[model samples]
Target: MASATLFHDVQQILTAEHPDPFRVLGMHTVSLGGELRLVVRTFQPGATAVSVTDEEGAEVAVMECGHEAGFFEAILPRGTSAFPYQLQVTWPEAGEPALMGDAFAFGPQIGEFDLYLMAEGTHLRLWDVLGAHPMTIDGVQGVHFGVWAPGARRVSVVGEFNLWDGRRHPMRLHPAQGVWEIFIPGVQDESLYRYEILPHQGSAFLKSDPLAFTAEVRPATASKVADLTKYEWNDAEWMRSRQEGDWCNRPMSIYEVHPGSWKRVPGEDDRPLTWREMAVDLVDYVADMGFTHVEFLPVMEHPYDPSWGYQVTGYFAPTSRFGGPDDFRYLVDALHQRGIGVILDWVPAHFPKDAFALRRFDGSALYEHADPRQGEHPEWGTLIFNFGRNEVRNFLISNALFWLDEYHADGLRVDAVASMLYLDYSRGPGQWVPNQYGGRENLEAVAFLQQLNTTVRDRHPGALMIAEESTAWPGVTQLAHLGGLGFHLKWNMGWMHDNLSFMSEQAIHRKYHFNLLTFSLMYAFSEKYVLPLSHDEVVHLKGSLMGKMPGDAWQKAANLRLMLGMMWGHPGKKLLFMGGEIGQWGEWNENRSLDWHLLADPLNAGVQRWMRDLNALYKREPAFWETDFSHEGFEWVDFRDVEQSVLSFVRRGGESGHELLFVCNFTPVPRYAYHVGAPSAGRWREVLNSDAEPYGGSNVGNGGVTETVPLAVHGREQALPLTLPPLGILILQRED
Candidate 1:
């Protein structure tokens, strides 16, 4: 038998007699009679021909997708909704059209889902790209709807399509699988949809589906409702460009911002600014900062404040709070035009109940798990996914690919990964489940993560993928073959917590916590890391970064400057949440604009100037850019000074050697003749000085120095000396 072809277009099918309309990712015939359904499939691109078999060795439903050009539509089984299935591509080749991959079971569900819920309403909107191709709704009828109520005897799916009605669309349950579904052709494309889940024992529950892409609400944590197909995308090059791997392994400096807080534009004040308003100002500001990237807090959609967008419901849609989907795409395009990449904060770990996309979808387990342990996240009080369920896995993975494929996102920072990987990551042992082996390992979750990274990387080689896993998990940024969980970078949480704590305490406290300051460097020693003064630190405990400072107002500002200087001194890449750059005095509030008025203040202006100068020096200094990934090129020159509240270090590049000596003084008292350490004795010149009067520092710098003086310690070129003032940082470069 000739291997089944995975795909053949209507043209190919009409012309060739036995032409397979779909490229056979794999193919296998199985006996679908009893508890088992097996099938085999063919492979075209990264597809590993799958063969599902019964106990009698007969094939059931084979899952596969090929890596060929022009094979976009997936041929799905009739009458069954595609909820969960694994889409695996070779890590470096996954993308639209053709990128070889695999699909596995997410329970009995078949297709991937797109849920990101909103706050309320019975109407739900579902959309997929293929939905636009044919302009017809086929096989979408009878899309099941049910609610999971171990406590419920019945569950129904209702929506706005039925006059805010759900009782009319009741879903039946699969006794063995514990799933509920409905065959609904009426809930077609672009329709506002929601499920009126009838709990068996309680009154009919009103909830949002967890699988909505564009919801009617925001933050996705409130009741989920969506107006699907409302936004129109204009950039085709974005999708094409993403598949090229044009944005990987590069130095990434992300400006984390909230759109609503970033700025407001005309026609959008009483009405919040649209994506266009954001694109105009934000693109220019980020470009001016020399930052190569911008990261948005779960901008897709959510309802309430989980503070910093850790809780998400809408997976496919951009937050209505920001703008429509196409409008968001335009913003991404604008960033791309400015040579800045866009990275979204993706939350796949859990979703809030306010989301209606999959809220009791089909009256049983649809987007999430049917069981309590599998569906609910104990620690976060959210809904967790069953990775072992193929349909659910596909739903998540497909969305990852969709953003890169449709929206032009250059990178993604997966939030709360630690929660996703471990059984009881934040909770105690009693909160989660363990693998068959009885250890802490959650094999299914691990496998899902592996597949996610692999598939995402394969699909968008140039786009970046990052993890926010706080646990010292091994191999977070390595290729799978190297036994690593693949990711480009991990947020240096340990450093942020330790450094912020050390800086927050009075100067006396910092001296005793030297190890805390000294040890963070080690975390950077492995894997590419970013020293993020991320939004995480400033908003929650005790207020803004400056608010955490121990001294008087002047001292507070000085220490804040010192902390920033230390950030520039460190070896890893750097990131600063918005407003931090200009010294916003208050904690982040989603409701208000960053206090741009503060920039008008002299002291704050100086802070801004210092930031600019520092960045200029950082960019110009060859030592900061070269061999930043390796350990040998970077070394801590010193950390012992306490009286003057100073810390100094050298950022060295590889053998193409450029030694950058950084001297920082935290105290407000003026200090002179600061002796900074260096590796060689050369005519040292001041490449840049943050203490220059233009940057709000004391007018006490010569602008340049030429000295090749000899040593107090000759082994590494003895003494490299300089002068410093309160809240000062000096960057010195070796003479050529």
Candidate 2:
């Protein structure tokens, strides 16, 4: 090649403007005087002199300064083949000359098949190839870094090893796949790093790795190099049982916990418990409370605490506020060992507008939409993901699987599914764009959700994909092939709203709102459901469950017990937020621990005891959940007694003949003789009564057992004359 052309190439390398750095910066073959010779080049900005050396530290040749900008090059002897080498550099201000392996010496770390899969947006384990991974390549140990930035002019791996200089280790770009990769030898685990991306038309900026397995703690956003393969998981039995168990029929009483405030160390500035601490404290509490699973608010990495983890920045990383990635794994393992499932809240609807994260990545709206109408979330002040884009879809779908695959999460409770389903969600007409068919439905998001559910179901059997959908969108819990979104379970927002509203009404006025209590059963079997009393109901001045009940102190306690009894007896799974079981008076505060002091109050202790007993009873009876989604499992004995503010129902255990009768009394007036239908002639034992003295009720109930009479009532062959408890529910089972 001509000398002038070589000088120009050297200038480009010195300035860090070379699109493909490997062609000029690493060892290569060149023709000189009709003979091919091996050449080595490097660009070290502050170095005074540079030399090439063999693997054994023997100097091959002293390099000449090809340019004044610290660009150095050397030609090896003729017939010298391309081989592994290191750069020995002497700095002007230094102590000893440093000898380090050339970051550009290694070949492509990502295989062609992986590249093809990435471009096609079908890479299920995208994190395996795209993030910083400590690996051995060609008998050398180094960290392989890869990122996707199609619009970037140049991308470099910048970190403490190279003094955070972008020019020192410019990555090799695979033009066809728009992926840049480099293997930096000696970059070990726990090293902090980030990407320096030079966009096509703007100044360069730094971004945390989207696929980072772990990140620096909050207030420090650098992504950390983690070795995720070292943890020895002991949940093999839990995993095997999970795959074989039928979750729909089995009991699932979830204790929803916000890790940040579930408990705090009063002696340590009230800081939240670490993952390891919670593994013992939180796991023991959930197990002793008889909850089947624990659902945590999003544990994914986020910068802002006020958002409560809804606005995610690092999808693949667990938040570092509590502990490291392995610490989180320890928490899950602990839960599994205690016979409890772990469900993580996943947010894919939108991400916060943090410049250091995914926003305007590559100086383009790459992860989100280019148009604000389609990209921005009006209510959240966040950016919605461009689900229509194949790469973006692949990002979110793979993230969902990442938690289940790496962290051993038994399920994911997808957040804000209602927002994803509608293009105009919280928008005022022109503020949003319509689909191609000119409708409000978000077609791309629907397709993405379907694909996400299908992939999770196919890859991990019995792993739940739950939807927090608040709309009447049909078939949310149906199979994907049957034209549904294919979620295993969906939160029943309507039931939660109606029942809470009813429970808040005064006893004298509850008759006017009787439909609110009975309305849920109308559509209870429409889809698989989880009746949730979540954090949403107890935050932002919405009031705690105890505060929402109408009446004086005693009446409030009675109403609270009645509400929980109804939820436990209802035809669905259950989820109750923290602080509810102990009957906290104030709303949930994210900044402080739950009101553990409330347990000292007898009324509050009664509520907690009632909740514990309710879960135990619910799980012990198949009639409560065995056929929850079918009409055959639930039978309303009577719904016409609105004047009395009372209702009766029967839960059946399919053909097993296991049945339980539920009679609810909303008014504070107890009835001495109330007749309820019985499925057969037998001694009906009062198994559980929310108004018992132990639960702070008046203890007004039948005397343990009531034998069925010969007289008919409510279209049944026999009837049971019973004493009804005021503002309480009684669960009775046949003893004959």
Candidate 3:
């Protein structure tokens, strides 16, 4: 070695240890014989000859091989100023010479302001600055790659273009912000890439980009460069109206669906439906059913199909199993055009411990906590996110906003929120650690949820933030500024559990468990609520909703109609799982399609017809949904009929003149001439009856109209004689 400094720099570049390769490997100025000269250095490890070509393709200097390891250099004359050049290299036994652009020729692409904001953890649009973004820089077109791996000794962009060689494109590190960025001249969309991170200790490993907009199909993990701006959206009207007001008082009947199993190709190996296919089929099917929205169980990318999208790997990219990222955008746009909103199931509670993903991301606990008590979820065999870390918080919050802003999602139903809120969740006394205040609540997670809700509402007003929180958390739907979690709606888990429990008993035994059906009203108005008969209820051998009813097949179908009617009549939004509408007998299995053949039978078809009518009636009549979150919207007419196993209630619409009365009989025995209180002395119309013949029920009900008499009953000045059908619910409205 002629110079010690040159020898050290060459070794570092060859060993892939140089944190910043631009200063040492690119063109530099040096002093020779008391005169300044231009020196060009290149590290083509396998090249036999290398030359520096000028801007006009003229050879300026033929580089001399300085080391047996393909280190080449050339120094120009003192009078020869620095000029734009390219590299022309010849490989041993190669047929022709190759010309290539120097990756280090470009300067830093990220702005300084973004770096500062990222360091402060306030960069809301961090996605724009990080990840693989294709752009043109200084008459050169390529991809700008950025990543956060503060703990790594060195990081390089490796892909098929670079022959998976780390020495080809070592990134420049921003030490203060812990970000590594570089402009790779000529990398474009559809290029598969991953980060080759050299940890400060141990062996190096490959990682898929955390902010990857799209990923290759599973069994082959690599990030694909996708241009999100190319897709043209057509949901202007929907977006404009969505931002105008809150959706609390609106009709929200959500049909929860798992896309992969919802529908499959007939006789074609059960192939899942593509996003484009779903757009054409699912959007219209849900529209025809009169559902206002469709809530998909986590559609984020995951390696295991059995996880049912719950264990997420690619948070930003929709699962490639359906289609490309643009395909997903098309699905959203199509649904929006049909006046149906989309709500995605978001899994921020925990993530699976996949080796190629976020686990030990930087050879350290970068995204999760170091201690098992704080980081690991024993029940799920997954890792819990470190909510207290600024970078981790930034990652999750940005992901939440990404779905809303980029994908045009109308709402987020955060899954397993109870797991995130409590430290002792599913754990024994000695196995968990409490917060600093010695409480069971995870304070950091609580703060993170508050921040997540606040940011989503402040930025995207009228967007819903729903929590699948099971416990009795205080004020889950209240505003954050008023000292609450700031969710727009919380799942009424208690109601679902109690209702199913009581409905499963025999008709004669239901009277003893009568309170199970009416106990939810005790605190129904405590938070904005959604009565969810979700996927969880039909899985894990819990049996289908129809199968849970204790009766013959005919009675079971009638009971399902009764349950659906009761859900709509209750003072809350409604969410029904996919197979529940058609009396599906089998429990939910994510591997296969729902039993679409069930609809061929009149018993099942009638249940489906009943569900469709329920949605139509629920949306049209404001009394069913207008004041769902307030105590004033509901009043108990009669709940003391324990021996008969019957109940009655009144629901009020926003208008003073709009009101409805509901009478329910839990048993399979008709009650004739049942007296129920009415609000006004007028004719009442029997608007909806679960015992109708069309809904797989025996025709047992009063005629369409009943006259109310001016007789005082149950604090109401009017009373009406009603015919309560067996295992049925009756909805009566005032005749105009």
Best candidate, lDDT-wise?
A: 2
Model 2 residue 547 lDDT score: 99
Global lDDT of each candidate: 0.61, 0.91, 0.90
Deviating ranges (above 4 Å) for candidate 2: none
- TM-score for every candidate vs. truth? 0.73, 0.98, 0.97
Best by TM-score: 2
Off by over 4 Å in 3: 54-58, 77-80, 91-94
Arrange candidates by TM-score, highest first: which order? 2, 3, 1
TM-score between model 2 and native: 0.98
Using lDDT as the measure, name the better of candidate 1 and candidate 2. Answer: 2
Candidate 3 structure quality by residue, lDDT tens digits, 1-736 = 3789878888898888986788877688888778888888888889999999876668889999987787788897558887777788898888787877677767788889998888776778778988899887767678989998899889999998888888888899999888999888778798999999999899889999989998999868899999888888999999999998668989999999999999999889999899999999999999999999999999888989889899998888899999999999999999999999999999998998998888888789988988988889999999999999887888888999999999999999999999999999988878888999999999999999999999999899989999999998898999899989999999999999998998889989988997898899998999999999999999999999989988899999988888888888999999999999889999999989899999999899999999999899888988888888888889999998989988999999876447989999989999998888897888999998989989888989998789988778888888998889999999999888
Q: 1 or 2, which is superior by TM-score?
A: 2
Residue 308, candidate 3: alpha-carbon lDDT: 89
lDDT of candidate 1 over 24-100, digit per residue (tens): 22232233433333233332222334333332334334444333421222333544333323332232343432222
Residue 174 of model 3 has an lDDT of 90
Which residue pairs in model 3 clash with each other? none
